[model samples]
Target: MTTFRKIAALAVAAVMTISMGACGNTGSSAADTQDLVVARSLETTDMLPQTGFSNGDIWAIQQVYQTLTRNKTDGSGVEPGLATSWKQSKDGLSWTFNLRRGVKFHNGRTMTAKDVKFSLDFARTARDDKPWQFLFTAIRNVEIVDDYTVRLDLNEPWAPLPSDLSMSASSIMPADFGGKTETEFRNNPVGTGPYKLGEWKKGDYIKFVRNPDYWETGKPKLNSVTFKYVSDANTRSQMVQSGQAQIDEFPTAVSVSSLKKTRNVHVESFPSTSLIWVNLNNRRKPLNDVHVRRAMAYAIDKEAIVRAIYYGQAEKANSMLSKNLMGYSKDVKDLEYDMAKAKEELAKSSAPKHFSLTVQVQSGDPEKSMLAQILQESWKELGIDVQLQTLDSTTVYSNRTAGDFDVAMFEMTNDISDPDEWMQYMFSSSANVNSGYRNEKVDALIKRAAADSNQANRLKDYAEVQQIIADEAPEIPLVYKPGLFAVRDQVKDFTVTTLGEYKLADTTIARE
Candidate 1:
């Protein structure tokens, strides 16, 4: 399917929440409410694909699914998950995975090649729109060689196929789980991950329990985990401090400051792969001009946003990729913040004066508000009036995909180990043309990186590609947002990964 159509479908899918059942500890009383509960500002919709895909949803599902390989929370590349061992063909068109035996799903089904085939095939053809679907589209098909062996056949030479499978979407599910409607599965679900879906009370909380027959033996450190969607950052922080929540994700810096004053909680940060930027709506007349786009970049100050909003948690971005990535280029620096330069570009342009644009951001995100305020003030200096609109995460993604907003701000991650996996989705004509961006040179470079397997060549090619995009100024780079997550002091053996995912298979929570 085309990227636009997929994004439209995803927008529609976001309207509904996944309904699941709640199961308490088998040995405890019904009134017991304590379970490694964590609070966050958003809730996930049920239409989420079975694949360990989607941006925000992966954080929750990371506890419920396992991939062929996993990242160690410290920003490392790919590591093992379900498949204990794997081998690739010399031609790089075929791959075989050797699954660890004695794995069982939450539904008591033995995990086998059939399940692997079912999970991968469903991800490739699932009806619901998922953000990471772009990662799996290269696969022609998957074949079950034996009870524990699976082989993947690709349409073309794709070296990153194994690393792509290491992502969330490649999580294996029971064969029977395939071909089911998203609505049906949302209400009732099963997986082979560490925890099983229990009760989901919409607008209240989602509860989970340890899976007795989980593929990984004798693990899942916590007895249970529950997630509550408390949209207010203050409320989420208070919950953690009051012992109502054991952990939380990205509490406001202000709230974190207060928590540090009294609570025994600990804060941890990992290198986030997300790159937040302004998607200049090129369909508009003035922004269509390269000078206007360049001017917009110069007017906004990234340093202020990092200091005032992020409190130095974020690193200013000059290129599409993060500094930690293999293909990142350090030659590009932050655009100079000069109102005089911005006015110069506006005067030079043949476009009319008094240009206006709208930026859509998430309502609850503090950084979004800070960015919006800064842009509004900075652009005003150049006789440009910009409107800032804040919406929920769901609304933001929906409008962005539909091209409803003129200029929008949001974040994107490098999902696979290779940059091609992400760059293709961003620059490919087939992907959602956020900002209505298109360039033949960018397209050619992305394809070249996809076909080339040599590490040195791929890096050079991708570096040139990033420089090309930076020069053209399609999307304005903002900052590499830090992955700030808080865990209770007692939650030992937990490692924060660069990809922002957790593998609970071997984790253990100790308490005296």
Candidate 2:
């Protein structure tokens, strides 16, 4: 009763198994396994921008659609996805892509340059300050060169433009479908990817069907995938163990030990640099004080939390930036639990007696609750009342962007491998206006890092930026999370990335 799952080289298929008592289990075929069930701890409530489901749902719909280019899962870099190949001009401001020949949308219409122009333009024109909208604004404009050729004009000399094109949000859809109202498009999506949306039972399940002529040369092996949202990690894991589901994501660190001892379940720990931090809103009263922020940093015991909650599977992060990141510093010391310092800060702060602080916590995510409780107890030692306010992830994230909380804990996974990726989103004045954290020095350093293409020079600039953040104390760093995923023994070719995205295009499921 052992299942080993690995995502294939292409990350499309998966290897999974369901064993019965003493009898060995056998895997099913694409025709028979048309119902591939997956359970996730995160819920997909509505299709809004910036969330995994909002974007991932669009990606699924686009699989019925297609993109101009694809990041080959083989790691050779960006290659032909919906587009056969592409080339850039010497100035690097303009680029052209040769579309895949004879590719048709799920609606049976042929893909054309108009489709490319319409999709990119619509995403950009439909911009909001939300993160997804920010992603789209990077493209200056797009034009139709021919029925099969499309060109993109850049606003700046972006080296990662090709990689950005491969993002799930950059998915291309039918031109006619572009200008439709949100409600209309959600009802009927015509993508060029491998799977077509068959049915969406709001709040329950989203069913997909394999496109008969998916552009990837007779792949989409599993016929269809059924994503069932279960916000509870224990329940999701149980669904997989009970033969009700094939794959499940985000099992708690506590359940890892027991799940590992189980007969047929295979677990893989992905080393991710995604770090959870206590974002001290500078606009708030007590938290607005720098000493108060620094004292809260000294109050939390990083070692105890990592050991007790994460089971020593995670690394203690000293700086807001992680060690695995490019500008990581080894000199930053751990902020041990110091009651004296916490008291000193409480006294130093001119705020009145009985000062209260609120820390927003997502309803079901275990780490948030655990971290909040640990921090609450630690802060209580200094006669401070720290309250944990539990809210739905949607509400919590929304309020965070709106600058409505005193203290909040959130984790960030680097989207790209650059110093700017970490600094740009959090400290830059532009992002700060939205995220509610701004430092002039941080803004300058980020601008320098973004402008400098040289790695060595960029590193120096980012190192200074990190030191500024360390001193400013707008946010307190906690721990670098390790992503945990479980696959059935029959599943193979799976790899989890630091970004927490599970790409299943090349995985294959086999009999155990």
Candidate 3:
């Protein structure tokens, strides 16, 4: 940083420090309300859960809708939600779920087998903007066994189905949607969860009210839950400290320490299936060669970045799979940060030492920006000129999908709580073909693991696949960022799942 830029940053920090004292707190009027507010960096215009994987959308929809299966609040595993019990066939082609009786939607309609089949059918057939359709693509048919039972017939044996059903995409809704059209239903959606949609101010905030006729007995402790949208991570942490929001969703990893030091604020972190990485386009020059990719990986320091950028909130990752993930292996050996190793690998590459390359990052991601700067300085030792280009999410994703850059920054999060749903995008030859990465061995292992019904065999396949991916080095892993949050001191019993789910059913606010 230049002297002038350093001075400007110090000035801004000074102003923020002074303002923190003047901000509100848990004792302030904002915290005195009966409702609990969660501050997030994004907003969801799409209220439907099956459409896209938005963190804010999942947090909101989970409060209003219940899926056939649900993640245990204590992070144990999948458990009964609307479905009282479920079992798969010995041949692994069919999955049968028994629904809970006397369950009611927000509109006072009782749930039945028809609702279960209808909801699954709605998710299976994608109409528009349904990125999670891949989760249900295996299902060829949905059959209503009885008024209280439903069965799903799959074209292939998809081992991820059971865990995938725990995602927000598999949420059960009223069969007729409470007599509302698509637009009308979106505006006033009804569900069988503990909360009801109250008001949604686009790009601003979404509010949910406690359901009076909820199936869960004596739950949803808060009178209302409001999700306030603030696009900056630093600002979200500040909001929690100021009591503007009782819970701050995924506060900046670098800012976790300072927020925890505050008297009225508490910082919480949990193991998560989130991996931040840089995909090296295997088809692009200077990055296409395995030696070049290996050299780049060795040259980049993940430990320094994770410590300085993520503070202590995350850990340096050796591979694409997070340690918290089910199929993660401790034996996969990837290139660690070593200047000597980098020089050794580069000597065998086409670029060898001197080459100017560009990496694309999404604008407004503070971590990515810091990471780019770190890369610019570190790779200079290897005679590499690193060029950074910041663009909007739409442009960044489009470029990534088109394989238009030498290197690109992105994060992979598991919404389904299963490794197959997230790992395939990184290593599977047929999946994410734009990455220009392919290996028959890795592809076969991924296929075997994804189709096998036996957990031990699946784990063995994934373990081998992870090693192959690390050795190939198509993508470089940076950090395994956990599900992090900042909350006011008064908020208690908030559980953070491996999938980063906001399990609010068990949360409680201190009355005192």
- Candidate 2, position 183, lDDT: 61
Worst 10 residues of 2 by lDDT: 1-10
Please give the lDDT score for candidate 2: 0.65
RMSD of each: 8.2, 7.2, 3.7
TM-score of 1: 0.87
Per-residue CA lDDT of model 1 for 162-205, tens digit only, reads 67887667777678674556566656666677888888886567
TM-score of each: 0.87, 0.83, 0.87
List clash counts for every candidate, in order: 12, 43, 0
Where's the lowest-lDDT run of ten residues in candidate 1? 15-24
Clashing pairs in 3: none
**Better by lDDT, candidate 3 or 1:** 3
Task: Report the lDDT tens digits of candidate 2 across residue range 90-209.
Answer: 776778899877887777778788888877776566534445444454468898888989889877655555655665556687775755675677566667766777887865777778
